[model samples]
Target: MRDLPARLRELLLETGYTLDGVRERLGTVAATALAREETTPALRATRDGDPLGTLIRLWWLGAPVEAPDWLPVDPLVEAGLLAVQDGLVSAKVHLQPWETGGYVVSDRKVRPGDPALREDHVVGAGGASANLAQLVSRRPAGRVLDLGTGCGVQVLHLAERAREIVATDVNRRALRMARLSWALSGIDGVDARQGSLFEPVEGERFDLVVSNPPFVISPRGRFTYRESGFEADGFCHDLVRLAPRFLSQGGTCQLLANWLHVEGEDWRDRVGGWLAGTGCDGWVVQRDVQDPAEYAELWLRDAAEQGTPRYRELYDDWLGWFEAMKVTGIGFGWITLHDSGSLDPVVRVEELGQRVELPVGGYVDEVLASVGVAHRLSDEELLGARLVLAEGVVEERTGPPGAEDPSRIVLRQTRGLCRTARVGTVEAALAGVCDGDYPLGPLLAAIAELTDQDAVDLRVRAPEALRPLIAEGFFHISTA
Candidate 1:
């Protein structure tokens, strides 16, 4: 059993069963179909009795195939990774090739028209998992913690830069699968513990903490991987409030979470209150919102409960709970907290539904730094500080091309958040000349002289205008 993972890894890689190998063999069409949960195309593509095809049919498609001679059927079945019935072998778990050149083992996906999921079913790489992976800072760290690591997807990414890693989960089965994943990926030295969020790591601090927790706001805690057993977004709130205590100075914590939007309440403030006193700089980006009905249907389909006889019953229960709890809608997004160890922590919450760049860890690091600088610096200090337009930023003017004075001026970024800001003539002039060579005060004074405005008022209002740009990562505090 102990050597099973290494043996599987060697066999898998040798048989060309890696992520790139699988994709190449399946081709684009079959791979796309598989992503949609339609396996017929992939099955057709892998009809040949080759090693890679056999592996795909058995593990990737969850389809039983004949145990070939080269396969270690006895050892795999003995290790509980495979089952053999009348010589047709099938995987007991979904052995997926992750993008990080690793394998993630989880319970087979529950698709529509399939049986209901088990309570402790561990989930694989889904949208939320990928989102949190992209959102976490990849900077090298002394120690890292992956809280509520379902199948340990985050741990794979963290392993690249973290000297030590600790992964915790309430579901022991998940921890088991995570260990398998880490071992299969050749990632060792990870401390896997079984306990609910922060419980196993009490009195310890990590340089980075990341979670794609069971943040679904649900009426019943049926799924251990998706529900926290807490009432109405309280789990997410508690996670946020409790995060600061476990973060080392300058450490960061990030998670993908869902929050309730009750009637007559601002969702921003509702989520912002989670970070108000956490002693960390926080940033919340609400990427999407779904009303109660939509939210219920999404999760129902997620568990493959849509066509089941109890589908209506479960849906009604969820909707009834939402109504009783006054949850008009639900907002899903990313929450990031940076332990800046400051007396006045800066917390910013806003909606960002627009498309942006991926692997946003570096961008997020910049955002935290810029927001902290914008928050901590005084007006006079901001004026004296040197500034530069961030990379990929371009200025645009509208209102009949060739007109003497444009009706609108906009500064937009082509990267990171891809944020756009409308600016006045003074701001436009400042943007054109801010090359990090001069202080903002002198530039604003020059723009004031050119635009016939008071330098004092320009300097005061400029900081207010620049703060948003800085926070959005459109501007940088020049280090030059």
Candidate 2:
């Protein structure tokens, strides 16, 4: 059979086919051909090579046709070594590092036969895959498991840092593609198994397990790439419930999943309950919440683009499914679990606007650090902890153009964590004067006299604003 790059070059040169056109044609071919290998050979041999050899060579070099090579050949790719992946497939390899010592890479979107001519039908590596990959914890681990290993993108990453790695997927086609990817990338020491979730490795344990599973909460298991067969968000819940069984002592599991936001229950608590009594510490961050209409439309558009018919009908079914279940919205997020049963686990619900490049490993470190600190400090101790104000603090007061009175006051810290605090004049003045040596009482008295306010009133109001700033790391109190 002709190399995929050659076939792609031939198609582009002879037929003036763009990548999208070729992908569409290939999708049609895949639907009817049954065996891609048998069909691809005939297509390649009969095709003319207009811009052929150059394109194929470019693909092999991992350099785009238009760009000059600046870096040495990626070690894994040059060796026939790591997985030769699609452009999108390579995106997944950049996701998470197991730790400072460990790295994860995978080829979740690769097909063996014709590398260059392969279609994007399988949903190999895309935004979701890349997002999850970026979010994987980079901490080193003894064992790592890549669940739902599509083309094994996560497995590749795990292989870098793990003493041992295991990857599992339900689709045999996906497994085949993953193997090809591994060979092309020159990565080894990965155990590729076939099964669903933890079934293939019932007795095995891992220091870290990472998955970008098929968490799309669809009514039917229509698409193998994105939808799980389990009903009513059961797949996500089961993963959360079952991850603990395979985790080693102090091990962690990081996953990206979608859950239904039902009408009656708090989504946060609902997800939190899934981890109860598993002897694990969990941190779940919900990033986005889409209502049923928006959810249905998004998935419907995705399906339609993938050539699924009856878009309108499918759209209705999705809404009906959500309505029947009383699901008002769908929550999308990341869930991280640690098997070491710490008393207080880090659970944060934050609104991360739109999409931003987040340093996943850095955030994971912060979470771990916060959890460690929480365990060491009692509630009372945390509350009573005196923190010195960070240095180089500045306050800016702004007023309307002709008004004598300032409309707003903003306080910003120049160093440390760099937080901003809004304040009243009294509070701002107090903060500016705080030198760690002065007692709160004397400062308030001095401020009261200067501003013509009652000392008692000054004392009462000043602490209210000052205490929060102090606790939040904006201001620190002196130990001396």
Candidate 3:
């Protein structure tokens, strides 16, 4: 395996075997088809004399092909990573270039009808992988931990700046695959372990922790990568509760999770209650919601268990489980917890239905940092702090047609969460005038004079008003 990295790198560089190179060789139509897991188009394009083309055709698309005598197949076969059975060199694992640089190696991409799919599947770059990677702070840290590190996708991102990376998974196969991916990416020094949750790091702590845990709310664990084999989102709930304990002071943990929305039960309270006694400041951003039927069907199709003659039986069983639990919907979101060491922890649970930009990690770090600052500051100190509107926050004014005094004024975010905040005339004016130049107290005093309102009253209420706006990324409190 060690020699394979260097050999692979040499061959790839010699052949220009990159994501862009493959796409260019295959063209748009075939590239798109290959992306959809259809090998026919890619097969037609890669039968040329190029070693890169042959490698892609045989390894990535999983299409059987005759190996040319020019390539070094013996080493890969001896390493147990490939097998040239039936005159066709087949990759034992899937290898594809990351959209960025480098490559990700994981279990072969399963087609819709592949009956040989294993139960303990280690997937790569699924939706939650992208979400968790984007939610986590990329800032340099002393050490980082990735729990449930399937394919070690998050470990690759954490390796950018983390001094040392530790990745743990219940599936040992995933840990092995994770190490393979690390080697494939031309990086090293990840402490990979086989264990569930924090078992491997019992007494250890870290500067950052990240996870895209097995959070699918499954009645049974039919698959290893998605289903946790836990009842009613227990995996997610427990991980959220347990992650904060292994963080150093002021350290942060981020994860992608799903929560059940039971009948007549508020989701915020259900998920929020999980953070009790954790002594960590927490924020939950709910991005998607699916009803019982929609949720069941999505995972069913995802596991490739749909459209079979037995589908009706499994479908009915899933619906029955949901009905028994009175689960109305499933909520999908990102969670960020910070060990700020505050006496009174701050917890914010919100749902942002609007589409946001990818990699909102910057906004998350900002929000958590601002929340810590808010907790540390006195009311007087908070009122005296200078603030400014965040970038991409624009003010919009609208009202009934022909009305001179606009009855509605909204602050809309063009990035991050893409949220809109409705503000009255006073708050709107305050947001407009804030330029990180004037402190909140003085600014409100100036507004007091213009509006004939009492300065003392404004000062008292201003801190409370700006508190949420700051935490929600509507405004920025200048620490400089």
Candidate 4:
């Protein structure tokens, strides 16, 4: 498999097979179907004998194809990427293309009619992988670590941004597959190590760390890629609790995780306990919450073992385990941390279920910077700073017909977190006119003068009113 990556790259280049090229040849519907792991539409579309078409059907659809003239298919056989049997060639591994113009290599999925995959089988870029990738921090760094780099999906992106990278995983097969993925993409020098959690990189710190860990909270699960083989939410808890030690100053760690939402307990404080003693500025944005049954069923389907007695047994075991643990629900989301050298570090927790734009990585940077800045300021100092409304922010007003002024005022942001804030008229006017031209003191003074309100009163209330807005990215402190 050493030269297989280069050989495959050469084959794809020779045949001009790219993400866009495949979509153009396969059409949108077939391409969409192929993305969902369905082969029928792609198989129907790729009936032609072209070299690229043959290769796509062979690798993506799990179908055998005759070798085309220009593809140089012998390298695939020599590299064990494909096997020739009964005069038809079939792929031994799946080479799925990502949005970054590179192919991610892994064991093929066990489709409905296909044989069951091994217990330790590594998956390609699945939904969770894509989610974490899209939300990965794009800010360049000196060194990066991809924790639990299954198939090296995040490592591919990190390699492009960092000077060096170390990709670690508990499963040796996952590390092997990651090496293959890096080679096939013509990416080199990624240090692939096999060890659980941070054991491989002990006593080492990195400028950036990214992971989509095996965070499924199940009762003694069997799979390696999704299940951590720990008690409920234990893996995620330990990961977060130990992450700050691995981050360099101002370095960021971004990962996806799940935490138990225990009955009669605030979920925020339950997760906040992980932040204790870490000293890093941590933020958890819970994107979704589900009851124990919904969470169990979702993972059961993900395992492709539904509607069977085995599935029922596993589901019941999960229910009994959660019940004994007093777990009523589960919260799933991204947890981001920035290493800060502060005696009193800050951690902000929020819930945002509404859809936001892709590449949510930039928001992590903003949140860390905002927390650092917002938490350090005194009220007088905050009042003296000049700020402006964030870009793409607009005010919307709604009320009954013929109303003089809309009863509700909403400030909607179309960038970053894409949050909408409801505010009173005073807050609305202040946020609307904060053009970076003046400090908050003068601005409130003028607003109070116009509204027949006491100038001293608004100034006294300004810090409490505006501090949250700035911290949440409703406005930005102007350096201009």
For every model shown, the clashing-pair count is 0, 28, 0, 0
lDDT string for model 4 (1-480, tens) is 456577778877677677777888899898788667687888888888777788778777778887665555677788677888877788888887777777888887666545555788888887888889878778889889999999999977777789999999998988888888888777899988899999999999999899999999988868899999988898999999998889988888889999999988999998888876788888888999999999999887776767655778888999999999899899999998888777778888889998887788756677678776787788898889998888888889999999887899998988778888888777898877899999988888888988899988888887887778788788888888
Ranking by TM-score: 1, 4, 3, 2
- TM-score per prediction, in order, is 0.98, 0.63, 0.94, 0.95
Candidate 3, 1-480: lDDT as tens digits: 558877776677677678788888899999788667677888888878578888787667877667678667888888777789888778888877765567777888877886645888888776677777777886789989988888878877878789999999989888888887788777798988888789999999999998888888877988888888888899998898888879999899888899999989999999989876789999888889999899989887776777777778878899999999999999999888889878889888899888888778766777787666765678888887888888899999998999978988999989877888888778899877888987888888889999899989888877777777777788878878
In model 1, the Cα lDDT at residue 162 comes to 93
lDDT of 3: 0.83
lDDT of each: 0.90, 0.62, 0.83, 0.84
Off by over 4 Å in 3: 374-378, 400-402, 454-456
| Model 1 weakest lDDT span, ten residues long | 108-117
Give me the overall lDDT of model 2: 0.62
**Candidate 1 TM-score versus the reference:** 0.98
Give the Å error, residue 282, model 1: 0.6
Residue 135's lDDT in candidate 4: 82
Candidates sorted by lDDT, best first: 1, 4, 3, 2
Candidate 1 lDDT over residue span 399-424, tens digit each: 98678999999999889888889888
